[model samples]
Target: MLLQRRALLGATAVLAAPSLARAQAPSWAARYPELVFAIIPSENASGVTERYGPFVNYLSRRLGTRVTLRIANDYAAVIEGQRAGNIHIASYGPSSFARALMTGAQITAFAIETNLDGTKGYYSVFYVKADSPYQRVEGLRGKNLGLVDPNSTSGNNVPRFALNKMGINPEQFFGRVVYTGSHENAVIALGQGTVDMAANWWNDEQESNLLRMERKGMVRAADFRIIFKSDQIVNSPVAYLNTLPDELKAAIRTAVLEVHRADEAAFNRIYEGKQGPLEAVDNAAYEPIIELNRFVDNLRRRG
Candidate 1:
């Protein structure tokens, strides 16, 4: 009878082990009742909120926690917020994400956006007024230029790298360089004659900064002309703070990946796509930007 009892107890323990482990697992929902989601200010704050609010709400319902949307005023704000642990999750530009990682921020990129045809990249374009005499990047020499941000991949880093590769130094080549803070603002500055030429992003489907503004009647296509366009740069990333428990991390990843299926139209509108889906990405995917960052850093240090 003792031997039989011992065997039964061992079997019961084996059956209960998985459940015990699961029950002992840390619950982020319990510890973190509210999670802050920060987005890079690709556009104005109000515009960012209006576009990303529904997506945040969906994450809240899917993760079973209250998620607040934060439209950071600039790229650095989002990076600093994540570094300080105030922002739980962030949609980061590639260059900004590289900067965040280099700065020792505890975060991991989980997903990246795609174009309407499922391409996973976009371009940096240099533009001038439609009637401007600038026919090439060199033609814009000694003219005032507008850049989005130092941490912007398409708006700043790529353009700088491209010019450097072409044997041109942007700081010395342009008469004056202005950081417009946001892509839309950079375009607006060009329209308001604040800068003779501007650098911003251009999507594969032609649905990006300039297009968004045109849709809202802010600028017309004919208002600007693309003088230079850089090679494909990977789309932005959605990253979560690594401080979250493993279970919560998995939940957040699942929620984001499944969001498109939950509301395809809303997802498309948020991303300005018709049927593109988010795909898993990692640090390796951003190596190009990392290289570009190094080049830009060296260039700055030399100046």
Candidate 2:
């Protein structure tokens, strides 16, 4: 009888363990039950899914909830998704994130990407065909320019800011301008000679949209030459809607900052270990981008 009682008691405790864990889940998690995480469209949707699959799975496990993955077709969609509270979490370029706030999207930036050297910035670069006679931005005047997306930071915003500083209005300078809709598409347009020049993001010689495309054999790095490189812009950031419960927000931020520590291989796959892990960040870090956006807005007004 004594042995049977002891065995029963042990079984009860074992069964209760799961209950305790469930109780620790965020108060709001009960209401949400599932969360939607959206990723900015830096690349194709299929590739985005393959790259983010493990990371999203890790987030689900860490948060003790079902986290669904959604790849945004454009930065505007991500911003709109968050604004409408349809997306619980989403990543954005610095300028895109800034645009969200400027346009009243009630979101908070929680984590920022970093360079391999631990710098929290990247650059906007102009790409032209290597054999093209044009060697400078001036030479490309009256030529078609490919901007990634209207909301893209390094893609359109920073590149335009750089041009405005050069006393050239993109609308009046370029024979024509087209938004290729993505970094990959910008290069695609350039490679196909659809556009004489394209603006894209570059972190370093080891990592860039060009290198990513090269790996897929879509374009040869040697075939393109970077004609202009803008000053380092703030790295992209992951953000959450402000409407979420504080506890949920904290958990999401903690989970993001510890992603590399929790699953180094998954995190490494995202950046190929060429970049550092995500770091804690907030709205203040993006003020410069907000200012930049404002400046760009003023330019539009002047134009």
Candidate 3:
């Protein structure tokens, strides 16, 4: 996704037609010369950096500042980083973002990721080995369950919510619940027989954690079957601190919104699949998820 500087620009002009030469440099940019951008490790650390490095470079050029990418070990680290005002910007799963705000992080969502279908939502699903005796959620009772992370939307929050909706309590229902630390690890655990089933995100047949692993030859898609899938959850978002100046927020928003148009290949590289244009969104978009987290939190409290 690297682009050489020349008469024709590739990702160099993601937000600026000429490296932000025309727009007035904001005071906030000078004060915060370098911005820390953290992301949850949906994949392994190196894989995450490889996937987002180009997009980070493009964002730096567009914002006329240095942007360092921090691949968090877990979702809580990202939420804490932003809460402490250390991470200037972050990419978050819906539930993690909601948790951040619920825990009193002063941030505002600027851009929402759109799926290839042009929808602003995805689903949480349960997966088991295709040959496993577990044919449904009921069959998985008394068997161990693998989850991505506690702060994860699809992997944690939504799965619990889905189970509770079905009158199932994860702790009592599953023989044991294990936190695999990531969607990748959850599926890996399933494949390795560390758990009977796992929870993850699925957006159509073409996009999912399973497909990504399958493409990398980590897991075969045919080896697993989805036993349950929750209702559509809000799409993930990229947000900035509320403390940032309005102009800086606008700059970040513009850069994100124009990413696909400014550099098709670079944008495509970030997703590694089909994607729709970015949508401008706000905190209101994730209120339901906050409630979902509240529900999950209460469940944890009772347990």
Full-model lDDT, candidate 2: 0.84
**What lDDT tens digits, residue by residue, belong to model 3 across residues 1-303?**
111211211111122222343357666755877777888779887677667877888888888888777777778888888888988999999988998898888999989999877899999999999998887798778899999988899999899988998889989999999999899999999999999999999998888889988988898999999999888998999999999888888888898899898877778888886568889999999999998988888888888
- Tens-digit per-residue lDDT, 231-301, candidate 2: 99989999999999898899889988999999997798688778998998999999999999889888888
Clashing pairs in 1: none
**For each candidate, what is the lDDT?**
0.80, 0.84, 0.84
| lDDT digits (tens) for residues 154-212 of candidate 1 | 88999888888898888898899999989999999999889998999988556767888
lDDT for model 3: 0.84
Per-residue error at 77 for model 2, in Å? Answer: 0.7
Query: What does the lDDT read for residue 216 in candidate 1?
Result: 75
* Candidate 1 regions with alpha-carbon error over 4 angstroms: 1-26
Model 2 residue 66 distance off true place after TM-score fit, in angstroms: 0.7
**Candidate 2 weakest lDDT stretch, 10 residues:** 5-14
lDDT of 1 at 268: 62
Candidate 1, residue 114: how far the Cα is off, in Å: 1.1
After TM-score superposition, what is the CA distance of residue 37 in candidate 1 from its true location, in Å? 0.3
Q: Point out where model 3 deviates above 4 Å.
A: 1-24
Per-residue lDDT value at 113 in model 1? 86
